[model samples]
Target: MVAPMSVWPWGNLGAFKYLLFGPFLAQVLYSRMGEDTAKSSWCLHLLIIWGLRLFIHLLLGSFGNMLFLNQTRRIIKQGVDFKQIDREWDWDNFLILQAFVAFMAYYIFPSLADLPLWNTRGLITVLVLHIGASEPLYYWVHRCFHGKYLFTNYHSLHHESAVPQPVTAGHATFLEHLILTAIAGIPILGSNWLGHGSLSLVCGYLVVFDVLRCLGHCNVEFIPYRIFERLPFLRYLIYTPTYHSLHHTDLDTNFCLFMPLFDAVGNTLNSKSWQLQKELNSGCGNYRRDIPDFVFLAHVVDLSSSMHAPFVFRSLASLPYATRLFLLPFLPIPFVVMLAMWAWAKTFVISFYNLRGRLHQTWAVPRFGFQYFLPFAAAGINKQIEEAILDADKLGVKVISLAALNKNEALNGGGTMFVNKHPDLKVCVVHGNTLTAAVILDDVPKDVTEVFLTGATSKLGRAIALYLCRRRVRVLMLTLSTERFEKIKKEAPADCQNYLVQVTKYQAARTCKTWIVGKWITPREQSWAPPGTHFHQFVVPPILSFRRDCTYGDLAAMRLPHDVQGLGSCEYTMDRGVVHACHAGGVVHLLEGWTHHEVGAIDVDRIDLVWNAALKHGFKSVSAPRTTSSSKSNFIS
Candidate 1:
């Protein structure tokens, strides 16, 4: 490089000072010489240009970058894992090449005397046309470098820093450094080729350009996703730190430098980038903006889940501060009551997938499944119903179907009690007795002539008795009193009065071959049925503690046999493959896109409608009609 000095007579001593220390000398001389000196003489302009470059890139750029990095460390204390930091540190030697790249760019363009001062047109060319023309050229070069031969031998070295630092922008080999220099020159040199560019414009562009380059590798997310949400058109104009991070993590994607236009044109943008943006948005300030919709869509305990299911944690946080304040006056009274209820109850939501269809559903617990437990004995029955409904709604459950005891005891006018108590709730509630009975009746063995229908005194029991009566099966109905029994008999379908047998004693139903348990029965020694008897339980969580000895489980409980292929983790709470028809009826309503509960009397047509829905949605019988277990699992036995 010093060979030039040997040729010129006075160059030897001058070359030593000017070539080596030109930028430093320029900085000092320009500071003292003033602007008039720079404008008057090209010699002074020459030194000042080098001086400005050194001042901006070496001094301001480095110091501002350090401050930004330090502030970022303060903002996020739980930084990357130790092993990742160590892995990145091992590649620190690569960043030293950056100065070499910068040195090449500084001297390679032209002598100061050859370059013109910045004109307005040249500045415009550098700002817009340079980026526009360079982007496509750089995109292709990047794609070529990603190819197998080039990637293995050269480009892969730059990818060593998965989470990059500011200095990592220039962490490339000598060949890559040349490639980087070329891509960077496209705007400056390409514009100069078109005859509108100046060295002043190129130098000025580099100063601003390096800021974005360093910021891109800073491993910081400085852009808000909502900015793109509001002004999506600008997404083409900006490249976030997250954008460049994607380039590192997903090596073949997002190859464009400053904008996404070519990447979109090439169709190589990482699909996960948008998803990651939404996840990042959730933690960002936009959470407050989404509160109204979340509050509107959320439920306490939803049996049906939708695609727009609200975030469960968001819903929990959305619980009004007023709710806590309302308990304040009552203080220890309401507080102690809640504490008592907590001791006595457990709450959970169970999800089921593939539904044999496009949708999935969840079952929230603390429900009145059966009478065996003290909670189901109506101790906290109202609270349980409220808890389930509230949580399901909070989970973004669109609708809830009150099944078994949830219908009769909690709300007297079907679901009206719940509606009145929770007027603010948007989750639709249904008694679902009509379709439930229809589904249950479909489970009754065709050969069976008699069914011991418990809870005959209630609306659910009466509905099932009618379905059985339609089938001409003898129904030995149990009622709480003779008065309720006579009322049901008179209200019952008159065509089969002789097939209906009213009994006050449950023991009398023992002679019946089949049982319809719409209500929970206590698990006393006398309550257990004989060996040949089969049971269809409408109740959930069975009154019995899941014993194999309990004569027949809910035959009405249907499951999707093919559902196992896509069930995923939602199968954790399922028994064999069967889901309770009552709990499942809500899912049926959801799949059918119905928002109301066809309950109270009985919707026989709805029964047929949902039966077809069950078949259409891929629900299959979990076991043989009278089989002791299902092939779904050994646990069923």
Candidate 2:
């Protein structure tokens, strides 16, 4: 029963495939020992196989200097600009030992003595079975390697190469290498147990498998896009070069080898594949390099009492309506008068390091007291914002976020005026209000049906109110003016989704389960609420808080966990465990791909993105939840 020429279908494609496979002697074993007995020692035979693999791999690395075999060699030379080509040799030092272990652990006997009766049907069946079985099995195994323990000790060594080369494909701990080799044998073992074994086909399959593995990791793409662009469906059948490269960069995505079927099934496909592939092909890593690595924006506030003017503004803002009106002439200069006093605060360049010890810096610009209370500040603030953009441009900021009054002034336009004004400049200005709203909403309890909100006329308050109404949640809009209160009530119905929204003005001596400190509420105004209720605080200059406080405060998304305290060391302090929401928005823009992405106004869709990113990075309230404890941190009654 002589196996026909088609029995070793891949064997005859000799010259180049044999050079690439390197185990030429194995090919000879198949040819000469068709029906012969094994006389030579099996140990020497196995050693020769491993030695040939290493030799062939080194041959490819060396020949990369001499000639081009596919586009892979040329790509390795230009793609990542890897300075140390010799580094692979360092990783290669372990190969012979790994190969010996692999042989001893699995391929011990003279399996070559019984080359199966190979047929075309068995070849196709086994190839398909190997691919199908390996996809899920390897997907699971690969995910397991990402576990914190295994990744730190074993699998992480391979991930050191952000830009992988061919040699890196085999670079792994002995355990990982063993696991890979063992899984490759599963299909063959199953076929043998089913009485349909074919060792000859297994040999060809291994050769193809190795070639594809190296090709994927080679850092060069030879697969013509025309094949997929024209046929489209063909992409699902085979993994592309970019597919594996994405897996190396993003840990949770692109988990499958050989085919992406399991990756798609598990919903782990890299969402940025197209954008990243284009960049990779252009010799850029997965992220943008066009802009400065870090950028931060700030809105300046006028100071009267300490840098935190909340104390000063509270006294003037909280006087009884008649008393405040009689004293209107003495009220802190109107925004117009203050606008004349505006000057760009000294721009501070902060140099710092992250938890990972990566050095980063930010440029902060202060706007002089432009919050809404200043009245005519909006129009004046726009011009100052222009000046801030110009200053930020001099330092080459890639992304900038508007804070506080600046965000409020630009809420509707969302810095579009600034963006449109500086069309020629290379700076991206964002309102960042979307993320502000997101973190605030994250602190609210999911089951709550009624929410008491202040600052009913302001953008932050309105955004929160509308958001609640759309979800059929009732909100009590605490307004000071009867005129403004009625206006809001009139517009509430049309603004809500299918649900009819309920909104009401706050009166004296009221109590509620949940209160949202939505506006730039003074410390005195905050006391008006029942001290027994739960509070979601969004004010930048938070009211002072102490242990065993009367009311509990919910703070969300603190960048510097060390900043949390019962009494803030800076100008103002938050209730213990409370964080500022706007801080997370700034960080999200910096770490996310530098797309010059500006989150303007309230895009519910973009808000979800920042919210997910904040949670993924563990940026949440780090203090104890509320209870009816009493303390003297900064009680104001």
Highest TM-score, which number? 1
Runs of candidate 1 exceeding 4 Å displacement:
1-275, 282-398, 403-413, 419-427, 522-530, 543-551, 560-566, 569-573, 623-637
Q: Which ten residues in a row have the lowest lDDT in candidate 1?
A: 289-298
RMSDs, each prediction? 21.2, 23.9
Return the TM-score for each candidate structure.
0.44, 0.40
Candidate 2, residue 340: CA error in Å? 14
Candidate-wise lDDT, in order: 0.53, 0.53
lDDT by residue (1-637, candidate 1, tens digit) is 3221112222224213234435435544674566634323443443454455433333322332232123232112122222332333222222223323444444554442355766567777666764667678778888998999778776776786444655456555556655565666666765666667665676677666766776666655556778888898777777877777788878879998777878889999877665565554455433221111111111222112111111111111111111223223544443453445346745433232343333344433333223314444554555666776687677566667764445655444565666777777766676656556766777787888988888676666777776677778889887768777776667656787678788767788766758777666776622545556667766543444333444555435566445432232212123434555555666666667776645466655466777778777776554343332211100000
Model 2 clashing residue pairs (backbone):
300-367, 301-369, 302-369, 555-579
lDDT of 2 by residue, 1-637 (tens): 4212212222234223333334435644664656432422233444555555555454433232221223222332222212222223234433444444434534554453354557466665676667778768898999998999778777777887555555677666656766777777666555654556564555555556666676667555556656666786666667766777777778899888777777778898887654445554454662322234444445434443222221122211111111223334544543453444455334443212232222233333434543544556566556666776786677576566665555554332666677666677776666666667776776777888877887655556667776777667777777766675555555555646433233443434256667777665554655656656667766654444442345656444454434221111121232322224564466566656446646344555466787777666656643445333322211010
Q: Model 2, 348: alpha-carbon shift in Å? A: 3.4
Worst 10 residues of 2 by lDDT: 314-323
The runs of at least 3 residues in candidate 2 whose Cα sits more than 4 Å from the true structure, single-residue gaps closed, are: 1-292, 299-346, 354-362, 366-381, 410-414, 479-504, 522-528, 543-549, 552-556, 560-579, 594-600, 622-637
Candidate 1 root-mean-square deviation in Å: 21.2
